[model samples]
Structure formats: structure tokens, C-alpha cells
Target: MSIAAIPTIKLELALQSPWMANQVAITRNNRLFLGLPRYSAEFSTPSLARQAADGSLQPFPGNSWNTWKPGDDGREAFVYLNSVHVFNDETVWCVDQGSLSAGVFGEQYSKPAPGAQKIVQLDAKNGAILRILRFDDHILPPGAQLNDLRFHGSLMYVSDSGLGGIIVHDLENGKTIRRLSGLSVVKASDKAPPAMLAHVKGGTTFHPPNSDMIEITADGKWLYWAAPTGPLYRVETRILRDMTRSDAEVASQVEAVYDNNFSGGCAMDSEGNVYFSETVTHNITVWSPTGKTAVLVSDPRLVRPDGSFISQDRKLYIPVKQPVNTVTANGKSEQRFNIYSINLPRHLDGIDLGRAITGV
Candidate 1:
């Protein structure tokens, strides 16, 4: 079914910070989870603050949700985490860049120990650290940084957008694979510009280093990836999981699945439809196997739509930032941002592709 128009209703989810909003995810129970990558300080906590089934918003204590166990001294922190995935009702894993002074840690005097990039697996229900998979010694180079991640079953695939490329991790074996270090994928006609091309306040541009978004097929056979400043690429799960291949050999096989330069994060629904923020045009684009490319939303109000999620109710929940015009729902335009819940003109009834299929 082709959607002629998307019905987006703007809610007043006014953001309190100006950091780069990354990704968002909605649980089956309507619990809303979001991520902020470049903020003032590491958000040491996480929770579902959305309105509950009873129509009441519940605010869990900051220390009660996603967090890190402090260093020896309570003041020394351990959280430059960015993206998170809530799975299996209780498991929640978050990516910690390890470089404590990066992102939200900017200019803060908190010193960080060398080699900190790691993924923390937490019990969402209890906020307890189930396991800490540090990658600095495994995947990242001496000065590189780890950014976002997505999980499937026992394996977690991460994107090292900082030093460029993707990192494949084996949770059970504590093994790591760093594929396509500096160049994600090379092509003869690839000339897409970076997604973060606009300048915001304080003369800041959204230029990131490497792959920024990663998604896995429901049955876990394919991994879709893209960078905020590079080409969109993907690889088969079998190649990624092979414990015998050399990094250079794996790089030789990495394929460019999509060439669109998605300036923002990419969202994939149950039906395998890929949605990406076309920052260059202030629009959202959806790509499907039918070889169809359609603009899902193009409202001027959708300035810099970043981390986004599609709910069971078929709603596209997006966290918007740095509006070109600062106008509210009422026509007053100024510079402001908010997290919006938009209703898709089409339902996701056909999104389930059943058992994931392999991708080139």
C-alpha cells in the first residue's frame, strides 16, 4: 500500500538539551526509550518516562534505571554511553564510547582512564550490570571511539563512526571484528555529501567520522548500516560471525547496499522497510524491496529529525533538533527542538517479512 501523505500530529515533547539526539526505541508495552549522544554530561540514567497505559507519565529515579557503577571514588564517573537496545523484556545494552571526555563529556575536568570503549549489558528491570564487554582492547584502535550499537540474540554489532567502519562482537566468546577501517565501501560513482552539513549555534557542524547507524534483520541474517558522513553499507551475518577471516579479507567483501547518505539515524520496521532522515532536504525517505523510494514526511517543522522509532500503533516517533525556524505548533518560528510522535498514513500490517533473509 502506498501512503499518499503522512499524518503527523505534533506533541509538546520539548527537549531540555541541545546535544545531538541519536536513536529511539519503543518496547511492546509502549515504554519509550531515547538516546542523546553529544550533551553537556553523560546521562547517567535511563528509563521510560512516557505516559503509561493509564495516561499518566511516570518518572523513575535517575539512579533507578540505566546507569554505570561509579569508579572507586563516587565522583569519578563511567558513562559516555550513547545508543541502547532493550530486548527480551529485561535485557538492555548500551554503548559506552570509553573516551570519557568525548560527547557529553566535553570540557568537563573528569579524567578518564585509557581504553574505555565498552558495551554494558544491563537488566532493565533491575538496572544491574549483567556484563561489561569492553572493546578498547578488542576492536578500537589506540585513539578511535565507539559510537552506536544494535543487538540480536547473543551477538551485538557496533559502529565505530569515530575511527570509521563497523565492529562485530561475539558476546559469548568476547571476540571482536573490525571491518573496513577507514573506508566503509568504495564505489566508482559515490559522491554523496555528509549528512551533518548545516551549521547550528556556536559554529557547530554535524560532521561525524564513520558509520553511525546499524540495524539487524528480525531473524538475524543481515545487518544494515550507514554513516552520518559516508555511504550506506551492509554484510551477511555469516561473514561477520566467521571467527577465521582476517580483517582485510572481510573488508574486501563488505558491500554497498544503499548509496543514499542518510544524515541521521535509520529505522527499519518489521516488514523490512528502511526509513532514513534525508538531512540534506529536511525529509524522511523509505526504501523497500519493491525498488520504491518515497518521502514519508516533509513538513518544514521536521527540522533535523534524528533518532527515530516506529511503534506498534504504526507511529513514527522522532526526536527533532535545531529547527531552521523556531516555530511552535502555532506559527511562531524560532530555533527550538522536541521529540515528536507522528502517525504514519499507512499501517505496518505488511511489515513482517518472516525469518530474516540474507543481503548482498
Candidate 2:
């Protein structure tokens, strides 16, 4: 569809924080939360923080929760927080990648530190930590990174961008299952073109072992995920949550949904409309329930748009990280990273899994 045919969306500046953020979460009351990944030592800000109106980063929940020393247990602190999701129950979930970039190339990062990989749930109303879920070393490889996650009932599915799979967490038993491990569909494509960023040199290619994005259906029945260079895929949540099913059995249940270019992050509205960013094209596209795809917004300023959040009021918030430039320059770059929001149509407001399941 032509750009002029799409609905006119006014890009609203939400927060202009000093530290670059990978993702954002908006609470029911409209509070803003930001996740700052430790891409390099230059990013010394709190891993997970609340963005104030003045663009200051406040240590979320508390200061001690954000502080981590070299010898300290990384599980207790916010170690390389990647994404944050605010649920309908007023709880905020945060994913910690548990490692730092050590080698010269972007793909050759360091191993995760001891007790580094985990998911923490915080009470949104009072900023209190409700629970912490740690992954075992055997299941979560040292190179494995938890990218993004979505909820379905009491279970949470997290995309492992580093190892190319999905980590299914059962809240009831605190047990974890790894699905689609080493699968070609979940892995980043070597043949796909490199991601283009305005300030990066020769563009940034898709590093192997990455499946960085994920989203759940409104009915909490299916999950959709993709790599940067994607043919988006989905699997029935019932197959994932079934403990009796073998890994091979579950893998067979996965199905391809749609082919897409290099996409960064995605979200699904109440109407089952899926929204995702095309990093190379600098535009946002929406896939309706009827299987039609159209550009939502396209602009030169959308440089490397990463994780996005659709708030309760029907506003889509995107974080423009320009990660290619940051990685190519080895984090020694200066770029003003900001959160931008565009108000979606009113019909898209209530189609999230949380509301659909609860009928609230």
C-alpha cells in the first residue's frame, strides 16, 4: 500500500533519556519503563529503570536491585536487561541477558556470568519485586540471550536470540523447557541482507544464532516470533505448555505465518492486528487478521527501531536504538536515542492476550 493511503500518524516524542534503551513498557496508569541493555561498558546506566518526565533514569523498584559488583551474584541484580513487559495484572516482567560484549565482532560476545540469566517480576503498583526465576546452566547456554517474552496463562515464553530458540517457563512449577533449539526457522538467516542504519558502515549483517522478536495472540493460543531477517513463525501455545510432549513433537507443531524483511520488534493488538518494524526500510507495517499487509508509518528518523509496546490507550511506542551504529563504533558513538509513539486506531485498543483471556 502507498504511504499516503495509510492513516496519518503524528510521531509523538515520549522520552529522551541520555542512555540508549532497547525496549519500553507502559503501565495501565501510563507510567513509562525502559530497559537498557549493556551492549558495551559505555552503557553504565541502570539495566532496568523508570523514565521520568524530565528524561532522568530512576533505579526501578530500588537502587540496590540495580547495583551489581564484579563478584556479586548477577541473579540478584539487573544484569544486561533486554526487555520489559507490563501485564494486565499490573506486574512488570524483565529479562536479563546475563552477559557483556567482549570480542571485537558483534556476534563474538562473552559468555554469560554465573547466575546471570533470569526473569524478574515486579509489582507495578508499588515497584516491589514479586518473583525471580533463574535458569539452569544446562538449559541456558553461556551464549544464550533472552531477547523478548510474552505471557499465556501462568506460563511465559521467552525468545532466545543468542541461541536461536524459545525458553518456556512454567510459573506453577518454576520449570523451564527449551523449544526449537538450533532450528533453521528460529535462527538468523546468513543469506539475508545486512541491516542498514544511517550512520553504520556497509550496514550490519544478521549475526548467526539470533531470533530476537516474539508476540502472543489475543486468545493466548498461539505465539508468533521471528529473527531480524524473518519468515515469521508461530506455534500453538497448547503444544508448548504440554509437558507430555517431546521436543521433536513440539517442533513439528510449529508453522510459518508470513515472510517478512529484517524486522526488529513486534506487537499484536486486540483486533489481532500485528505490528512490526522494518529496520532496513525505516517503516512500520501492520498485518491484519485477514492476512493483508500494509505500511503503518515510514520515516527517515526511524533508524533501527527495536522493541515496541502498545499501551492501553492504543498508542504504539517504539525505541529507536540504532544498534548497528552503536555496535560498529563499539559503543563509542554519540546518537540521541528517543522513544516515539504513534496513536493507533481506537478499534485496536483491547485485543491483547491479557484482556482477551480475562474478558476485562
Candidate 3:
């Protein structure tokens, strides 16, 4: 379907409810999950929220999971949500980094408690937390800034953007290892748009995170990612999944793939096409699996599009926010703080492709 085919009236209604969200996801049944990271929120907010087709928002999983206060024990609640995912259509995985910025460590952002900095995995049907995956200081470090994640078989790959590394965790064996930390590719290249570089408060801040967003191909062969200020890179999933591989072995498999200039959030379709939200250009572009690039959508309302999701119906849902608009524009981004979506081609949604396709 063409982008213009999206109803004008519905798009207008979607624009009416403006909320700054870091990420957005859609379930097989069409449920919308919004990741509203708390560290940057100016008002009281739900770190993870669920929005219905009628435009109502509610604390996802439950209110208890979203009501953690400053001094409260955060083990049962969310500290700061950087990314949220609907795993295999029946589960939700919420990535809580436990801090204001992922790169600044040893601050109070370690989730308010020892085990608080973890992934909250819950059953989508009952809203019951099925399990929690905790990363100790040795594995996660304090305020390691777990940015985003991709699942492969019995393993999961998490981006430690804060400290510069990709954490490979084994769900079945419970072994976690941080790889590619020594590679400059996993760290911020300090190549953010020169226009935003002059901003007094922006991406150039001391704690610039590395290896920010993550994506897994449809065949689970390659994993692509980069810092928010980026040049997309990829590595073999087999190397990351093999828990026995040494750090050097895994690092050797890394490859600099696409030159995805400073981008916000991204998502991959089952056909291996990746849709990147161009933060600097304020546009949406797609990189085909075969290494070609093209602009998919362009709009003034797409200011700083962050983490996005491609629905089973092939609609790319995006959340727009402009954290540095104070220097970028007067109030362009603030006015359009909305969850916008563009209709895509017949490509399948990655996460909703099939059950255990990676041989869980």
C-alpha cells in the first residue's frame, strides 16, 4: 500500500494525541506497546505503556510494574525503559537500563536495587510477569545502559551502549558474555550531524552511548546495529550465539555494513529490509537486504523518530520525539510528539515471522 493510502482522518486523529515515546511495538492481534523511557520524561509517566486502537493508554503488564518511585525497590517495577519488544507474539520483553543515560555509570540509575537492572519478561495474554533476567555487576555492570536486544535461539543479544559492548546471554545455560567492546564500531564514532553538534545540550554530551539500537535479520544470520549517531554495522549471529567462542573470535566476525548516518530507532522486516528513522534529516529510509537504500517516508511530523515496530500487517509504527530540538528547531518536534505509522509493502514482520524459527 502507498503511504498516502493511510486514511487522512485517522492520521489526523493519531496526531491529536502527542506523547513522546522512545519506542513502539505492535502485537499480532494489533495491540500497540509504547516505550516511554522515564529518565527523560518531564512528567510522571509509565515507562512501558499499552495503547489501544481507540487511542487510550494504560500502564502495560500492570500499573504496579510502572509505578516505581525514586526510593522504591525497583525489582518488581520498571526503572527506566530504553526498549520494549513483543517476543514471538505471546511475550513482552522490557529493557530497563536503570539510569538517566546509558553511558554514565556508577550513578543512582542502577535500578534502585541490586537486581532491579534487568529485563522484565511477561506473558502477553495474562499480563503476568513470567520471569526476570538479571545481569550482575560482572556481566551488566552498574548503569551499563542496556540499550536494545534481539533474540536468537536460546540466546539473546543486548546492546550495552553505555559501556560499549554487545552482551550475549544464554537463556538456557544462563551464561552471559560481553563481546566487541574493544571494537570502535561498537562505540560512538563521534560523527553526529554537525548541525546538532553546536547544541549546548545534545548527543555530544560526555556519556554518548555506543551500539545503541539492534536488529536481527529474518534468517537469523546477521545482526545489525550502531550508535544513535551511526554507521550501521553487522556481525554473524552464529558467532554471537556460540557461547564457547572467545572474545577475539567473535570480534573477528564483525563487519561494517551500511553508512547509516545519524539515525534514531530502527526495525527489520522479514525480508531483511531495515527501516531507519533519520534523526538529522527527519526522514524514514529503508536498506534492503541486498545492500541498496531508498527513502521510504518523509514528513515534518517525523521529528527524531525513535524505536519503531513493523506490524504483522506491514505498517511501520514509529514514535517521534525531539530531545535536542531546543537547538534544532524552535518547537517543531514538541508539537508533533506522536506515534505515527507508514504502510509498508508485503514484507513480513520479523518478530512475528514464526514460532522458534531460530531453533529455540
Q: Which candidate leads the pack in lDDT? A: 2
Which lDDT value does model 1 have at 88? 51
Alpha carbon lDDT of each predicted model: 0.57, 0.72, 0.69
Q: Which candidate leads in TM-score?
A: 2
Give me the overall lDDT of model 2: 0.72
Q: Estimate each model's TM-score.
A: 0.73, 0.84, 0.83
How do the residues 1-360 of candidate 3 rate in per-residue lDDT, one tens digit apiece? 112211221222133223458887767786777788764434566787777557787677676888876767777888888888875645778888755532333345444367677888877666788888887777776546688888867678899887778888888888888777647878888777666555443233443468898887766788888887777888887787676987678877878777776777888776667778888776676776566666666676677778888766766777777532322355444332577766664432221222212212
TM-score of 2: 0.84
Q: What does each candidate score in C-alpha RMSD?
A: 6.0, 5.2, 6.0
lDDT of 3: 0.69
- TM-score of candidate 3 versus the correct structure, residues matched by position: 0.83
- Expressed as tens digits, the lDDT of each residue in 1-360 for candidate 1 is 453434453333533322344555566566655554434343333322333456443432245333443342212223455665655544556676644432334433233355345666655444466777665544677545676776677677777766666777766777777776766452212344533445342334434556677777766777777776546566787886676876677766777666664456667765567778766676776766454556666666666677676666677777775533355688875443366665665543333222211211
Q: What TM-score does model 1 achieve against the real structure?
A: 0.73
lDDT of 2 by residue, 1-360 (tens): 332225466678776666678788888787788888765554566777786657576878776778864456676787678888887776789988776555422433356666777788998757788988778866686667888888877778899998788888878787888887777768876546633322242234325437788888767877888887777888888887687987678878888777776777777776666778777788887776555677777887787788888888778899887532333356575545688898775432222222222112
Task: Estimate candidate 2's RMSD in Å.
Answer: 5.2
Lowest lDDT 10-mer window, candidate 1?
351-360
Stretches off by above 4 angstroms in model 2 are 1-7, 53-55, 69-72, 104-109, 195-209, 323-335, 346-360
